[model samples]
Each structure stands twice: as C-alpha cells, then as structure tokens.
Target: MFDFIKTQVIGVTTPTVDFIPTAEDLPAFCARVSNPDNQKNFDTAAGLLKYCMRVGHWSVFDMSNIVIEIEAPRDIARQVLRHSSIKFQEFSQRYAVAQNFVIREARLQDTKNRQNSIDTENNYLQEAWKLKQEQVLNLVRENYQWALDSGIAKECARVILPEGNTMSYMYANGTVRQWITYLKVRDDLGVTQKEHVDLARKIKPAIIAHFPFLEELMEK
Candidate 1:
C-alpha cells in the first residue's frame, strides 16, 4: 500500500514593477539597430545582440528580472533549475527539523484558497489520487533516508525523488522577458490559473512603456 514519492508547489513570484525606459529612447534604440552606420561605431557583436533582443526576436528577456518564490515539488525543482542562468534559493527541510512541513493535495483542496491543489478542473480524483500521492511521497522520503543511513551521501540519496517534492526559490532579475514568453505559451490554452494571467497582464503594461511598438503589437 506504500509506494512513496513526494511533491508539492512551494513557491510563487512577484515582479519588481518600477523602472520605465523613455519613449524617445525606444525610437532611437530602433534606429540604432536599424542603421548599420550607427551600429558600426559601437561594439559590433554586442550591438547586434542587443538589437535582436529589443524587438523580442529572441530571448532578450534574460536582461530583466521577475523574482517568484515557487513552491515547487523537488521533482519540479530539478526540472526548473535546468535553466542554468537563473538563480535559486530554497528552504532546507533537512536542516529545519521543527516545522510541520507535511502537506497533502487533499488537505489543500478543502481550503479557502484552492490554489494549493492542481487546477485539474474535470478530472476528479475522489480517493485514488490522495492515496497515490501519499505513496509517492512516502517512498521518496523513506528511500532517501534509507540511502543516507546506509552510507550513501544525502546528495546521492536524492536521485529517486520525483517532481512533486516541493521547494522554494527566487528567480531573480532578468527573468521578465522569459516571463513574456511564459505568458504567451501558458495563456494559449485558457487553462492557466487566474493568478498567473493577472501577473502577465500587469507586467506587460509596465514593460510596454519601455518598448512602445512592442506594446502596440502585443496589446493589440
């Protein structure tokens, strides 16, 4: 009955909302990129890279930041950290032994805020899900501890953890542009949660002030 693995969302992020680029600056920026003569005077490779980024042709969003604390399961965190450039800081459950860190999706589903659970609108788990999730977390934790006790390093013991083992992190500055892509990709399905949609809506307006033509296009 106990097939254990662990997972949870342990963080979410909010962007820093100030700092706007000037309107005149946007046109001049476009001009600088458009004119090879002007581009020639500056550092060639650096200038070209900046030019492509300004218009959102590629991942220029890495320049700005939006720090979110994601309550991600350990399994999810592993995937999340694959973006090598992004920064992350998580709470250490191994060190913080006193807190009641256990959380079940079932318990959160009954709460005033429904966010702690999955937004699976139609797939009602009833009872099987609760049991399944428990088994997963238990197995992951037990195996991890067992490996450590048996002479394996804690680091090596964590290999069996699943995507649901939750953790927290601050995806610091230079993440906003990637977030624009995040908004676009996640929004298409109409299945994204309202909280994220609202965040994208808010940040886009601010970002547009720095990039008017972009504002004109995206806002339309």
Candidate 2:
C-alpha cells in the first residue's frame, strides 16, 4: 500500500543562500538592477526582496528556480499539474507497469463545499470503505497483471486502473515565484485536496532549507 508521501529537492539554482551576494541572490539582484540608485549590500538585497514581495513585484522571484521529485497518487499528481506554469515529467503508466497504489482512510464528502471532505467518526463506514477500496484495488491489479501476461499493450491495459490505483513519481520544475504561487493555492488556501495539502507540506521544508529567504513568502 502506498500510504506515504515522499518529496525530494533534486535541483536548485543555488545550494546555499546567505547574506553575501552571489548567484544565490538572483531575486534580490534582479530587484537591485531595476534601479540605478540601489547599492550593493546584503541589507539592500534583503530589503529589495522584501519590498518586491510586498509591492506585488513577483517577477523578480522568477530569477531563481527549484526542481522537486514528488511521489504521490495519480489524482494528487493531476492537481499539481493544474498549475500550468510549472513544468513536469511524470512516470508513464503507458510505458511501465504500476507497482503500488495509494489507499487511505475515507472521509465524508463535504456538502457545504463540494470540493472538500470532512473526517467522520463512523467506524462502520470507515471499515466498509477500506474493505471495498482494498478489494477493488487488488482486483484491478490482478487484471492489469493478467493483461500484461497476455501480451496486451501497457498503454491499453492501463485504462482499467482508477486514479487512486497508481502511484506516480513526478519531477516538477518551476521558478521560485511559481513555487510560491503553487504552494499558496495548494497549502495555504484551505481548499485543496487533503492529500495534496500534505504533499505541499512535505515540499515546503525542502525548498526552505535551500532558500531560507522564501520561508515567509510561502506562508499565510
């Protein structure tokens, strides 16, 4: 059962960001170059970055980039792909067989907001859902394997798998500005799928560790 979320920062424009200026200071540097009067100093760079974010000058943040490898369900991966600005390459089910599935405790659908779900205390419902989910997933896996054994093309055989029946590895690349925007919608907005919210939570710390300056920008 693939009941875990995994995220890794595969690449970054700068490995370390500090007060001293270098390529790591691209966002602040871009902001600085926008005006002839700005001086070269750590304080100035830091101030410029903050000012840019404060005044909605998001373009400056596009100077730096981050690449992340995320392991999640196909459904959650689709959600991440909704941010069109971020580029992505996902594990292709058409080319390879699915090895695992994402199964989790089922939640009651939110009536007030169709896009949301709420945790329920009904043990019987939860147990029944778990049993049905497992049965369906196992049956599909067996069918997929049988199809492959019968020489059916993976591309055609993959059609029987449900969205949650596949675990996808997605490599996503985006500018710091885009990452911030994506996280804001998925993490801070309180409207995203719970699984995606959890995935974003894992990704945020990795980015922050590399670019400490982005910490505040990612928050509400």
What are the per-residue Cα lDDT tens digits for candidate 1 across 1-220? Answer: 1112222222223223232133323233334555746633323433444456556556443444445545434443454455555566666544432111233343224265444334443435536676686677777777776777798765566556553434433333335456456546434324443333443455455555544445544643
Off by over 4 Å in 2: 1-3, 15-24, 34-40
Report the number of the highest-TM-score candidate: 2
Alpha-carbon deviation at 12 in model 1, angstroms: 16
Model 2 has a clash total of: 0
> TM-score for all predictions?
0.43, 0.89
Candidate 1 to truth, TM: 0.43
- The lDDT for every candidate, in the order shown, is 0.45, 0.81
- The ten-residue window of minimal lDDT in model 2 covers 15-24
Model 1 clash number: 33
lDDT of 2 at 97: 88
